[model samples]
Target chain A: MAVEILKENYAGKVLSMTIGVGDRAVTVGGATALPFHSFEGEVGNRPLIAYEVLDTVPEDPPASLQEELESVWDDPVKWAKYCQDEQGARAIALRLVSTDPDGQDASPESAAETVKKVLDAIDIPLVILGCFKEAKDGPVLKAAADAARGCNCLIGKAQEENYKTIAAAATANGHKLIAFSNLDFNLAKQINILLSQADFDINNIVTDPTASALGYGLEYTYSVIERIRAAGLMQNDAMMQPPMFLDLSSVVWKVKEVKASEEDLPEWGDRTERAVHWEAATATSLLMAGAEIMVMTSPRAIQTVEKTIDQLMA
Target chain B: MLLIGERINVITKAQRAAMEARDPKPIQEIAKAQVEAGATMLDINIGPAEDDGPQLMDWIVKTVQEVVQVPLCLDTTNLDAIRAGLKAHNNEWGKPMINSTSGETVRLNTFMPVAAEFQCDIIGLCLSGSGLPADANERCAIAVDIMGKAAEVGLPIENIHLDPLVLMLNGNQEQAMHCINAVEMFQTLNDPPMKTVVGLSNIANTAPMEMKGILTAVFYKMLVDAGLSGAIIDTLEKDFMEVVRTGDPASVYPAEHVEKTMKVMRGEIMYAHSFLEV
Candidate 1:
């Protein structure tokens, strides 16, 4: 049977770019189709997964993950290098966790230094993330954006309230911006619209539909991503068409299933195995739902996710 | 243009009987045949048949998708049935079409989001609370309104198919003409011409035998001229086949392929040429 190719030809195009540089650089591209369904439609590039590095030590990480990152977690640059050199990470996502208000209250200068250190150590595309807290992230991300100037890195987690400063910084520093929004598809679209209306070229924007862990509203995440992709293709909704980025590891790690001890959930089986599976499952699902780039942790879990993606693309 | 084969409706006795018996073989056969007949989609409707509409729609959609690569158009007024069909087939390409809706604000309010969520195309009928428009002007007005509403919800106009509600010859001889005129009007109004279609046999319903043939030909001719892309017509009819052949000026048959297929269909083409060489 001759299949009718459903090609989406639209007025606006989604911006695509690899966040990091050099050997670890992961190429991100956009096709107006669902993930890995080229025969049915068009998907220009396979989803890329980036391993995450924390600027400050995590309060409590699963034993399985701790075992992997124990040696280098103290230094953000070393952690970034470990992800790229040893774990074969396609990109490095440096989370400025120290800037969190309740955390170390690390100054903007410190965050800038961390950004410089990671950039110097790894040449792959870099995604410098702001601390989740809006007030603290404003200054920290500004400093980090300046330090990473002209490296062509992508910096983000720019929310509705703090987008002005972050977008200006990104515009000035020659970096891509990640427009973060709540779980709602419309809100994600609105944020993109807001940015573009402010003269921020949407082609440089990647949307982050705030991720939820496996078994924790993951279906909602899947639906949101799927909706965004459909809007881009079938509806040709310009504002919602940007390549989506999923913060896969942070969401997966924070879930109880990943952190719960063997005694806490006996039926869940081994904690480490379950935790890795949780991350893998969550990341895989997001990829299927049209996540172009993912920021993840756990080298073994990354391996599993990459394998799943290989099979899906195959 | 997406062809949603509207053959599974329980409005027909045979279809109702098939649904009542919980027998999906006939519906599945219809769906498969439509797909083979160049339909990129099949509309499954088991509306209020005492049988499980949702379950039947799901089964047929899945069964059809398993055999045919084309998508299914879930045609039912029942929301549950539509949801069921969506759940049963989860593939991206197999996305279902929510068969129809009128432009009434209340109806659009409910239907638009579902269409968006399911990522399906919708068929918009040109009618409002004033009922089916009596003339082409009113019909075109309703159609434009529906198109605007669809656009407002971010539905690309190409994804919307406008049905101008063809009327039977027995009721009004001019109904077909009105529908054709509306199609032309809609074509001009739409940015990228929206797909226009109708039930081809509707114009002939209860009409005199001679009148049916003449009206069908006239209706089809007007539709063709007005840029009607597709319709739910009887594929078995010689007249319909002729219309399909001449529908578009650009659809010239590939002579070799046509001859081969026609010969095979007639059992004249053989596969044993080498073996029979003496």
Candidate 2:
């Protein structure tokens, strides 16, 4: 008997959407087959990388990130500029952490100022993330969205509780919206259905099922993304076809394996190298599991993942 | 799962009347509603329309395609009617599917060439001219014949969908298991594995009216888990549609209903008049 290769014929393709404006715009998520299964169908665009730039300075930053970004920590514009210029970042994710009600409680007006300054400093695309506080995010993201209007930026994280105002702001300003959900396929799909019901163009939406670090429930996140992608490709589900977004930096940096000191655990290897490897491993695993847009910190980790993407795309 | 809506058939009173009157409102309304409710394809069954089958199929195909942008499955015993529907199809969304061809030599010889020429999908019924098969192995035997014909005509394996006919649960209980097993068997019969579809409601056809919904929904979950690809089902049933959308039948149906349905499926208990009560 002759050995024959079995290939799956997919019925659907992931909808590709472009963010940013002019020649610097980035398009993602148009895979007719599974992620990197290029022999089966067209894998549209390469997975994109966006460096995380925080609005507020952290009290206890990792040694590797602090060493690299210490000079630009206090200034959001300089931080974004350094990531864009020196780090060779393709895009920047401006996280409005100071707007958290439990933290600095920075007003929406101040968040808007930072957004405007970052937009002026970077030539690449921008992704405006919220403080993760449902109530505060509505106003802060709206202000930030207004400040970056017509920039074709990606603004997000419209959750189940506060999608109305954020979706409105993204729609009104001609920017794309990120629909965030917990680590469940149903919840992720429900958010997209809700946004569609609200008259938001389904093509302009990106799915963000919340991410977890490598050791901290990464498998659950991986399964959710895999299910979402299968629903889009195998089932031809219209609502689940949008590209997926993952915030690897926020979760990867907080894990114990990534932040532990070498003196505390001498057998675990060097602190800086271990942290970078942790971030890179989490990112590459999810990328294979089907992640199109990833927000990551640690310039070295970003570079490592970028190299891995090139190898996979090749 | 490719959810093919089963609402636009001539068996329904409104649909039959609309087809008789040549009215497009009632038919188009159901087509649009099914698409809105997450039906990727609609089955347009015009039952043995020996006389005006061709014209009726053409009109309905054009009518439905005008309003929505999903594929249509032209279902009838009339070959000319199937051809007319195919001719009238716009192909803006996708090619029209012929529902379907069976292992019977005449039907297979006639339709496989058309399916190959159009390069659209066609459902392969896993039965012979003698009637429905007795077991999964018998169904596979017939499927081999169908695949041979499809190959002779150069039909792409991906475009071929094998349907292991769903039997009623009230009496032919063992055949239900065979149907599910046949679906699993059809998947491995080809290199680029063949797709599978089922008339999902047939399993619950003779059940109590009140028990039909749970019966079909639970059976749908079983077929999906067994690797069945497409299902012709009532897409408007919210609970059943929930299972279709989320693929979590355990969450949508009641716990006892799911367990009872499983018992019947496994042949642990006979399907009876008081099946749900048991």
Best by lDDT: 2
DockQ of candidate 2 is: 0.02
lDDT of 2 by residue, A1-314 (tens): 99888999998899999998988899998899999999899988998989999998976898878877899989889899999889888899999999999989999999999999999988899999999999999999999999999998999889989999999999889999999988867568778878888889889999998888899999999988997788788767777789999999879998888788989998999999999999999999999889999999989999999999999999
Which one is best on TM-score?
A: 2
| Model 2's TM-score against the true structure | 0.57
What RMSD does each model have against the real structure? 22.0, 20.0
Fraction of native contacts (fnat) of each candidate: 0.00, 0.00
Is model 1 an incorrect, acceptable, medium or high docking prediction?
A: incorrect
Q: Where in model 1 is the C-alpha error above 4 Å?
A: A1-14, A22-24, B1-278
Residue pairs in candidate 1 whose N, alpha carbon or C atoms collide under 3 angstroms: A19-A125, A19-A126, A20-A124, A20-A125, A20-A126, A21-A123, A21-A124, A21-A125
Alpha carbon lDDT of residue A130, candidate 1?
81
Native-referenced TM-scores of chain A, all candidate models = 0.94, 0.98
Estimate the lDDT of model 2. Answer: 0.89
| Model 2 per-residue lDDT tens digits across residues B36-78 | 9999999999999998999999999999999999999999999
Model 2, which residues run further than 4 Å from truth?
A: B1-278
